[model samples]
Target: MSKTLTFRHVSYLWDEAKALELAGNEVDLFIYRSNLLGADLRLTNYAGGNTSVKIMETDPLTGQPVPVMWVKGSGGDIGTLTKAGCANLYVDRLHALKSRYRGLEFEDEMVELFNHCLFDPKCATPSIDTPLHGLLPYKHIDHLHPDALIAIAASKDGEAIMKEIWGNQMAWIPWQRPGFDLGLKLEQAVQENPNLRGIILGGHGLFTWGETSYESYINTLEVIEQASEYLEQRYGKKSPVFGGARLENTDEQTRKNRAADLMPTLRGLASSYRRMIGHYTDDARVLEYINSNDLDRLAPKGTSCPDHFLRTKIRPLVLDEPEKLAQKSADELKAYLTGKFEAYRADYAAYYERCKHDNSPAMRDPNPVVILWPTVGMFTFAKDKQTARVAAEFYTNAINVMKGAEAVSEYVGLPEQEAFDIEYWLLEEAKLQRMPKPKSLSGKIAYVTGGTGGIGKAICEALLQEGACIVAVDRNLLDETQTDLRKRYGKDNALSAAIDVTDVATINDSLRQATLQFGGVDIIVNCAGLSISKPLAETTQKDWDILQDVLVKGQFLVSQEAVVILRKQGLGGDIVNIASKNGLVAGPNNVAYGTAKAAQLHMSRLLAAELGPEKIRVNTVNPDAVLRGSKIWEGEWAAGRAKAYGISIEELPAHYAKRTLLNEEILAEDIAKAVRVFVDGSLSKSTGNVLNVDGGVAMAFVR
Candidate 1:
């Protein structure tokens, strides 16, 4: 069997690059080939693999030609990589850093070398394996720890078998923890045979190099194809079809909505002690692997590669007494999970003690990244979504590789000692230390009404920017707003609900939807209301009832219902209501609108007093002259305001802007910012107070 690279895409890039200068031209070819390889699960799983190309550029400082390696960066995934994704490192300086490696400690020196040395001073941190590419003499390199190749690399007689299969074409080197020393080992292996096209790391992955991107990429395929063929010919029939993308069959509880129903319960358990997010999937592949009869034995055999232990723990946790898990109550299941997690921690501690070497780093957060429930499915947890998804992909591939290995020969993983060394390696530990602290409301959720436009949309956007999940409430679902929001944050971050604030059933149902999607709502903003302008002489019972129905009665209905759930959740909550300055000051024609807003102002205070014991804080923001784009100011309302002020429609905005002490018109964003200040607890001790977001309007100021 033979494998081939898809060169059509990269060929087009090269044809266009003939006109480009050498310094920045290598990036297009590298990006095209990287994306091509990354799109195939066989070439790269999640963010596990890397690619690089070295080119010569003139140094502006000295007018001398310098070698620059445009290597994949630390946090960039190859699938979506761009020219900005590569870290430009000076190849000569990277090699020179080796001289400092003699006396410095392995872990500390490697971290510092990757951090400080760069050909482009402003480039992001380079991959920890940059030296492996920099010291190599080839112009192009592709390094992917593909599953089929790993299956052979991780076998007991992996080297001998690789030699038998390919003779001198593939050189097998024994496993060493990744660092400055591993780079030296790769360099030696390359020098061992200049004719060699690929180097197989004993417990690591494959490195294939060539003078052009296409040549290097094709070499990877050839090695993988041969390895896949070897396993099939040896024991293809006996293999249990591991490493598939989805499940062949599913139980009742593992199907459709039932699987999604389990996410809130599992996420609540996963984040109980620490605050990690959960991503659940009963994909055919994950379900197939966990539900197999042989999973009990294979689940504890260690991970596919050494670097994997850093994200996924050394192995996944198989639930204790799996037969009794699915039928239990949510509380009972959570308690059982807690007990099982404690046992896992104990086992992890024992493993660490047995494997620690001198200068080994302290243990990291011990929560299992992957958890398997016998009846339901699998769930992966991490602090964010991308890492959780990546962990799931690695485990999915692990299932296939291990099963494929067993079919050929017994599966052999990296020794526990090697796993421990890589897990606590200084280079891997520093990535965590370098991350910036999270935002104040990273895990909180905000439910906002009137979310499509005016002040509602602004509040929704503001909350998402602060790391909180947003549920945008309106009279109907806003698909455009949802699409735009999902594009910015993720699909999980923004949601929409349809409800007339006056309807309790619709309001309660939407609240239930928010709870189901994200665990619970932590903040509430009641901004749904319409403006009614009517003079005392012209006011009808109909106008009065409509204004009161929306501003006062409707506001009460929505807030009280949300507060009921907040009390049950027992988590402290914040409620910010959008009020109007007309509530405090009245004009000749403001009979209906002013009175309804005044009732809302008092209702906020009453709720604050009643719910204070439950730790639910309530406040109000009075926005004046936010008429630039508000629906409230559209037809009859704008005409009425103009009639009261005795001005034409064109002069209405200027009149309001000069009415303020600061003489500036207040925008919807200004009101949104004021609402955000309240929710983030900047005014934690000052609830039941009104914030004047009218650019210093003297008439709206409260004493």
Candidate 2:
């Protein structure tokens, strides 16, 4: 049999001269370009797909008039069609013509370029799909061969596939020609079934329609999305996972909930390694992946899409134990790459050789996109913070689609060569490029009870990098209008409250005000507790009560209140307690601070475990002698620093940095990065974990 459709070519004419006489004005060319881009992405290798829409105009006297149809004009590839490529024609005449020859052959009509038998000289030729659109009652219609959809349709038992996936919500039409024949079949199908949402054209393409342009577009996509989701679930494939709006205008509560889930795991992992994870809390893929059942599943069947290959790899690198897990993941990646692409290692060789052509540029890291651990699931690999985030996004989306495809059957994606080409292609090179990211805590909502101190400011700025919105609480009042911190972050995102962390009533009221002003708090980085770096020998009973009230009791009251609101909202929230590194490893002079921090750490762990069932994740960051810009850093540290390390007070940070393997100074940004990670998705599976942000100072006892 002859093919149902044939390719054709057409180009646009610069008809800007007719701009003055048009009804409803000329459709913007940019929209057409965007549509073309979307279409190409959906159906690059597929054929026999189409798209159309209808436009309306007012009647002179009747005050209501019939609408005109402007389908994707004939004789052009939708892959490259511009606004000028589409034609508008009379809807009534087109419908009348289609009424006859309802099941005719494709060669019935012959019209000149930009001309129609019923169209006036002023009008363009009706699209070949005019009849199809006219036959349907919807105002807009689109058809495309999305790869994710095709993957399922091309599989065995495709009809059974529709029944299982759509659950009889969709109308399945056998393959038919694209002209009058298909139009008539669609009309009959619709009349036979009034409640049909859209038709799975079967081995051809999908067809979705709506009363409005945008609705039609979204509906068309939604059908494919639902189907793709089903398929991924069975075969274990993922689609583009993380491409959320990263604007300042997103829902604060949702972002905060994400941060809450992400922070503890991130801090725990980074503290263990003295390295940072993701940069932002709302870094798209990280948030979605964290929320995915796939990630939470005991045995995840890998990723859902091809683009995820570069970031998440074909499947998540599952790890239960960090040290052994890292090694196992690396080995598995090497083996998979070796087995799938025999001569492809030569590609890596060629790539490195090519890089050698330029001496200034650094060699690219050969690590795959992400490493997934059992408790600390999903770590991305990037040369810098931004690149790592992009890779994470790609991996998350790809994994989602891949998982969705798996539900239909085994997911066999585009060949390994295609994946390799996309990963190494120069077109995708921009993803690896890094630019200075916006503040890490830019849009994050943080509640800091003791905000005026050295530790509080440092924590605030750290939250700033991950784009967090900060709520700075201090017992002392200051002129809010004079500062740039509140002004730059927006008074809405950053709020200053005068309340003591120890006062339960004041904290309760302050939290309500902060939630109302900033929407809700996601990361509660408690830096308000008191600390006395005194020896255990001289510590008084009164000093211990005061410290515990502020550090331990204060945290409990604050976290419990936040959890109530969080549970009602149905999104997982986070709580980050600022515990001393001494809590994890001991310190000689300071007894109360260490004890309180240790208690705080236990509380975080307990809260994380208890809240796990409720989707609330809590954790603590234990920092070692955060003295640089802190008030405590300036005080008696001169004497204690000398006593502890036999060095001057100025040499403590350097002394601390040297204690770690990486030998990097512990910038407040480092701790903040950990906080963002905990709030991102680095430790998605972790809650009751503690992160040591003290330059790996105490590694004697490992978790």
Candidate 3:
């Protein structure tokens, strides 16, 4: 039977003009080509691929021309790679290291030698795959983990399929851990078949090369485009992908709500070893895979691509069916999930025991990084949001690979031992060990109401600096604040939303967005409020109602909604209310605002008492006169306070400072620091407590 083929082609994105512009510098042209390849995720995942170019550089010590290889540095993504992000090494030295190779058992020692070969001592560190490029005789090389090619490389008959697709033009190499040995294998393959254009590493990825950077880039794309076409043709022939749907997909909103409801529990479970931030996706492709009949069969078989499983784990923990999940009460659901989580941990432990070598690093977190719920979607947990999101993306890539492979032939996962060795590999462990210590609030998610306001923004920045993912909730979201936050902290680390804490619907929506954005909220900062300073006689019913609505009711509603998630997560959380010193001190022209502040103070106490059983701590930070950068002081409140104190508005800061024991002016950042003190694990044992950030206001001292 003639093999079916289709014409779904990947575009050749190389720009000859751009290439020509950078042609004078081989390294620049190589980086330019890498960026283009990485720009298309279909070609390779974020930071999953490596590219290289060989150039002759004058040696600084010898003052003689030497061949140097520039490849992507460790942990750098090609799409965003700069010249600084590339590792430059002496090509002759790299080849010389081959003489020291003591075979596969000693391949790992080669990585340490790479540092000695660096042309520049300050150059970015070399990656494990450096030998793969350096050992090759080709001028340019591209090693990518494209889904289409991997689909063929992962199939049971991948070698046969490779022959059918490229005939003798492409070669095949059985799975080998990326190292000097794999480099030698690649070198051997090319030497054996001088006419070959590329080689597919079985159950791993693709490697293509050329004499020039542009040719290498084009050849890589051509191979991927051909694989895509071949897969597309056969994919159509297979009726009902993934054996058709087993469960119907829930509507988008329903899926989101379900995910939100369950995320806290999932996150809590996944955080068994250490706290983990989460990312959820209900993308059409994810939903299709989750709802498929073959999900049970295919998902457990795990991912074939090393890059896919490195982030996603060997396999995912597939949750129960939608009907069963929907029917379970919160308690029942928790129990059911708890059981599943324990089983997954046990299985992971068993795998570790079965595969661990004497020198294997201690088994890391046994929690599942990726979890799939039948009707809802995929949930990925990691040390941070970016990793979680990338894990989901990798799994989605794996799903696509599985789909294509199943169409033409059976999908084959890396053998259990192979997957385990890669996961527990000494080199990977060293990389993990080299990572910087996580910030205090790492893996935490914080929701700050009135987030665009001066104090709120400061609080958000403080929390973000400590590594918390921020959902900046405000009554009116500012584009500038959003842009600044996203730019500085990254889109995944910071989010801005316009929400009214008084409106339950808006509060619900914001929390839902938070849950979907970063799993669930671990910190609730009720900073969204307004103040009305008026003497008792002048304070109208309208003034009282609005103050109560925004200052008291807003805190209550936002806290009330956020607690649902906190409880579901079963993890202790922090709720810091930005109360005022007026709550404790008797002050003139502060009837409405003081009354609302008093309510907020006591409400925090009440919540702390009520939520103590659930380990949720609620604390209050009372600021007496936070003048600079406070929106409250930017309006009528400042004038009212100044008049009440018989001073000019400009004199208020000094006046308030003089009244304090410390005689120090309180700023918005000072108030923000107080909030940080409450939630930043500094006062973990304290609850229902009021901490004054008023430069030592005597009357406001918590009794």
Candidate that scores best on lDDT: 3
Please estimate how well model 1 matches the true structure, expressed as its whole-model Cα lDDT.
Answer: 0.76
Question: How does each model score on TM-score?
Answer: 0.81, 0.38, 0.97
Please, what are the lDDT tens digits per residue for candidate 2 over residues 1-703? 1111212111122134443334244244323422542444443221124566666655444668657655555444465555665666556665665544523433234222225433334443454455666678766677655656655543445567777767656677764334556676788878888776677664445677766444554465566656655554544233332222222223556444433343333322322222222333344434444444444441234432333444544343333323332454544743443443333234444555553423223434333335443223355533334445545555544443433344454444434443444445442343345335544343345777677666676666556545666767777643452165666643434567777767777876676655444335666777776667677787788878888888898888888876755553444667778777767767677787778878888888888778889777887777665656665565564566567567876677778778876677776656666766777656777777677777666452446
Between candidates 1 and 2, the lDDT winner: 1
- Better-scoring candidate (TM-score), 2 or 3: 3
Please provide, for model 3 over 1-703, each residue's C-alpha lDDT reduced to its tens digit, 9 standing for 90 to 100.
1122322565466777887788788889898989988888899999898999999999999999999999999999998988999999999999999888999888888999999899999999999999999988989999999999999999999999999999999999998889999998999999999988898999999999888887787788778888988888887486779999888877888888888888888998998799999999998989889999899899889998888989988889999977887798877888999999999999999999999899899998999999999889999999999999999999999999999899889999988999998898988888889999999899889999999998899999989988999999997656778789989988889988879888999999989989889989999999987878888898999999999999999999999999999988878999999998989998888888988999999999899999998899999988877778888888888888888888899988789889889889988888888888888788899999988888887777767
**lDDT by residue (tens digit), candidate 1, 1-703:** 1335333211212233542433356777787778767788776676777899998888878999988889888877787888787898878888888877873255456656765668787786787778778788889999887777887777777787788879998888788766677777788888988888888887678898877776766776777777877876765475445433222354554343443444444554556445555555666656666766667777888775764655677888876434466678867876776687788878888898898877778876666788876545677877655566677777777765776567666677667877887787666677768888776567677888888767888888888887778889897548888888989988768889887888898887777667555645678998987887768989899999998988888889989888765654556689999998988987779999999989999999999998888888999999987887687888888898888888998898899888788899889889989988998767877679899887777767787
Candidate 3: the clashing residue pairs are none
Candidate 3 Cα lDDT to native? 0.89
TM-score between model 2 and native: 0.38
Which residues of candidate 3, in runs, are more than 4 Å off?
A: 1-12, 15-17
